[model samples]
Target chain A: MGDYFVLAISSIFINNILLAQYLGNCPFLGTSKKMETAVGMGMAVIFVLVMAGIITWITNTFFLVKFDLEYLRTVVFILVIASLVQFVEMFLKKSIPALYAGLGIFLPLITTNCAVMGVCLILVNEEYNFMQALVASFCYAVGFALALILFAGVRERILLARVPTPLQDTSIALVTAGILSLTFFAFKGMV
Target chain B: MAKSLTQEFVKGLWDEVPPFRLVLGLCPTLAVTKAVENGIGMGVATTFVLVFSNILISSMRNVIPSKVRIASFIVIIATFVTIAELLMQAYTYPLFKKLGIFIPLIVVNCIILGRAEAFASKRGVFRSFLDGLGIGIGFTLSLVALAAVRELLGTGSLTFWVKPIQILGPSFKPFSFMVEAPGAFVALGLMLCIMNLAGRK
Candidate 1:
């Protein structure tokens, strides 16, 4: 449907999880040192966020909502994410060693990465149904991936730019993030 | 043993601080720190969960296998986060509603889990407690500072319990952006720069 495309575009630029919502910024500022690593991390995050959203949606709608144990949502969701990350790591390692080699380190890190969990929370809060949740997760993951890659590219450029020692690493990253966030603010008018 | 325990405890406050120094827990630090009150509330709640969970995890570290340590640590941390959520609801209903989902989202807060795996799992119970306390206080202090600057700049008047605590009163107008998202980044970035400069000195 046109609605799904709209959702994807809008979420990716306008309602961006990092620049707009300020979620999952740890990787944005921390892991964006190199473009290749950023690309790898972004793809890894995309897979994790979509899978997390889907699994959490199913778990919430069927188990938490039906059983009236909605209070356990946080506990259950975290456990699921951790296990899911583990499963993915093993699966990728066995099936596609090259892909695994690229994403392997980031996989363990993604388990605790707030972005994956944050997307699931957003889907639940937005009250997206199973199908909508899937679409939203896919869009949101892509958005996060896009933001990561963009920042990584910028940071790679930044590395060559003669910078002061004090503002070298995290400070420069934060300033860059602030600028990106301001740019993303322009998307507020789109939706 | 004792000196290292002190080192672990002190590190969280300054050297290994969650938000400002280490930049670990960015989500809550930026999101909930719109106001001084919210920041303090979130900081204390997170500290409670972090300290307690660190204690429990450190004590049980020997039993949990290396292969499944991370999963077990998360479950343990989640249990405490749940308890903290319930306590917040029971005692501070108004604050609970204000905090909303962030309370539960504490389950995934990297600071707590990072401490569990990095320090607590390898340390003894008493030292873990001390480390947790130090880190928790440090996190709380940073949140309070960020919230204070944001609240003072954004609101024109800081408030607690619906009463305005005036610093400059009606004579001063607030810069609303300080209460917004970009303001969080600007203020934190500036503060980080200042702090790093001071540390170098």
Candidate 2:
């Protein structure tokens, strides 16, 4: 139990997926401009990340490892993720129409987002068991959502504040993201 | 045709520089840049993948159906990425380990896909080759520049290879913060700001 707690806190706070691990930052900056979009992206990521994490783990253990096709991990994992994302989009649209309406557009984007792929790779590297992988994946996605939402809030406000002409859009967003990442460091030693 | 190819090549140096100007491939840009050596390793690895994938995809552009072109491009990119990974492990094991996940994650890098779809698919093989080379070098330059700033401030030294060459004397206390996770963002942010300022004038 204590070990699980540590993993949760560490993944969500200390070694956050976005701030600390530097995964999934492309969407971190792009979708973070508006709060709704950030929220949408975050939900889509958490939903997909948890499933991908579990699915990839099983694939690696039973399929890749069994065949000693470890060299093809990159190619295999990507294909798995791409197909999974496609499947999820179709299912969401068919069964969960309302929910799909919200997360539909963001779904395709998650296919390419590095956070999902990065976390899956980490899951393999860490050699975590099934339960641990599940927990870690969920927490990491939560961490991504938390950071994205927080950054979105700050960015929305920064839009109004008077700033230099040159540092208008992406330049300023990056600077703010840096400060946000700095604040996350406070979570260190908490676990 | 010759002038245009040169123009295409030179454009990636400044006009469409992968990280700075194009603003694609931020994942690797932020991660794996803690050391100058890491930056070079990453840049070279990415360049290898980019140049080859562009050439292959460009040549096979017509055969790839438009509907599945993105998928085709990804498969092609992933194949090269795997090749790059194996080559790195065979030659530069330490740097390979340093760049671990980010190396495979390169398959999803926006810059590679962006160039594949935007430039390579529509252009000639030679033109795509030039485009990839130019952009790859631009990406390496950006990585090295960012890595230098972080490593220098974070450690008071620059590491081109295994050894750290101390540029700032013994008395200097490393800013340390610049090399940490947060420091990558801050350094890149400040650098982007500086780029903007320079571009304006």
Candidate 3:
């Protein structure tokens, strides 16, 4: 229980997927212009990340490791993520049209989001058991969501305060994200 | 024909240069560029995957159905990425470990996939190869520049393969922050701002 708690806290705060680990940054910068879009993308990422994590773990253990086809992990994992994103897109479009509309193009974009692939690779590298892999995956996604939402709030505020010409748009957002990442360092010793 | 091929190659240098002008593949650009070696390693690995995948995809563009083209492109990209990963592990163990997950994460690097869909699928095989090489080299140069600034400021030194060259004397105190995660963003952000300013004039 303590170990799981530590894992959760560390992954969410110290090893933040967006701020520290540098995964899932394309969406972090792109979708963060609006708070609503950020939240929607975050939720979609969490859902897919957790599901892909578990599925990849099962495949890694049963198929890749069994056959000593570790080299195939990258190819296989990406195929899984691509197909999984497609499935989620179709399912959401049918079952929850409103949410699908909210997510819009970002849902399809999640197929290439590095955070999802990064989590799968990290869990495999750490050699986590099934339970630990699930927990770590969940924590990483939570961290991604936490950072994305927080950055979205910052960006929304920055929309009004930008005084410079060259430093507007992505330039300002990158600098703001840098400062946010700096703040995340304060949690380094927590775990 | 030769002129157009050169055009495809030269365009990626500045006009469509990624992670800066194009803003694609920022993840690896920010993550592995702390050291110049890692930057080059990641860049070359990406170039290998990009060039080959682009060529292969261009050649196969006719056979793949349009509806599932994205999926097919991904599978092809992932295969090349796996090859790059395995080759790196076999030849460059230290750099491979330093790059770590970012290497495999190249499968998701927007530049590779973006090129395949936007350029490779529509162009001929030779043109796609040039596009990939140009973009890959541009990415490498950008990474090296970023890594150089970060290393010099963060550690007061720079290194390629051998011993670190001391850029600052013992009296100089490294900023340290320039080498960390925040520094990567701040540095790249400032660089982009400068690039923006320069581009206007």
Candidate 4:
């Protein structure tokens, strides 16, 4: 129980998926311009990541390892994620139209989000059992969301600042992210 | 059409250079570029996968149904990525360990899939190959440049292969921060700003 708590905390703060691990950066920079979109994307990522983590872990443990097809994990995991995203998209579109509309294009884009795939890969590489993988994946998604929301808030503030022309859009955003990452660094060694 | 092939190839070098202009594959661009060797190793591995996958996807573009094209493209890209991972592990053991998960993460690098979806699927096999080569080289160049700055400033020296050559004076104190996560963003951000400023002229 304590191990899970530590794992969750470490994943969320110290080993943040976006800031430290550098996964899911495309959306981190892209969808983070607006707080609403950031929250929506965050929810979507959390959903997909946790689900993908569990499914991939089950398949990896039961099917791949059993069959000695471990080398095919990358291909298999990606295909699973792609299909899972598609399934989630359809299910949301039908069951929760508001969320489906809110997420919009970003939903489909989640298929390529490295964070989801990264979590699955990390679960396998770290050799986590089922429960640990579940907790870690959820926490990683939370960490990604935490960073995105905070960065979006920072970017929102930066929009008002008189920035230079060359560093206007992504350049400045990246610098802000750098600063944010540095701030996150303060949380290091806490675990 | 023949002339356009050269145009497609040339554009990725500067006009559509990745992680800077396209901003597609920032994950690996930021993650593995702390050192020059890792940057080159990653860039070359990605290039190998991109070039081959582009060709393979281009050739199969006709047979693959449009509905399932993305899945097919991913499978093809994943195969090449696996090949790159295995090859790197065999020959470049140390660099392989340095890279770790980012190598396999190349499958989701976005540049590869972006090229497949944007350029490869619509073009002929030969043209797709050129597009991949151009973008791959461009990405490699940008990554190496980023890695060079980080290594020099962060460590006060640049390492090639296993040997470390001191570039800065012995009295120089390395910034250290320039090689960490935040430094990657700041360095790439500043570089982008410079590139933008230069391109305006």
Which candidate should be chosen as best, given TM-score against the real structure?
Answer: 2
Of the candidates numbered 2 and 3, which has the greater TM-score value? 2
lDDT of 2 by residue, B49-90 (tens): 999999999999999999988888889999999999999899
Tens-place lDDT digits, model 3, residues B16-92: 88889998899999998788888889889999999999999999999999999999999999888888888989998
Residue by residue across A114-150, what tens digits does model 2's lDDT show?
A: 9999999999999999999999999999999999999
**Ranking by TM-score, best first?**
2, 4, 3, 1
**Predicted model with the maximum lDDT:** 2
Cα lDDT tens digits, model 4, B82-173, are 99998988999999999989988999999999999998999898999999999999999999999999999999888767777899998999
Q: Docking category for candidate 3?
A: high
Whole-model alpha-carbon lDDT for candidate 3: 0.91
Clashes of each: 0, 0, 0, 0
* CAPRI-style grade of the A/B interface in model 2: high
True contacts kept of each: 0.51, 0.71, 0.83, 0.84
lDDT tens readout by residue for model 3, A1-191: 99999988998999999999999999999999999989999988888899999999999999999999988999899998888888888998999998888775787889899999999989999999998999999999999999999999999899889448988899989999999999998888676
Docking class of 1: medium
Q: Can you give the TM-score per candidate against the true fold?
A: 0.94, 0.98, 0.97, 0.97
Each model's C-alpha lDDT? 0.85, 0.93, 0.91, 0.92
| Cα displacement (Å) at residue A25, model 4 | 0.5
DockQ of candidate 2 (2 decimals):
0.82
- Over all chains combined, what TM-score does candidate 1 have? 0.94
Off by over 4 Å in 4: B1-4
Better of 1 and 2 by TM-score: 2
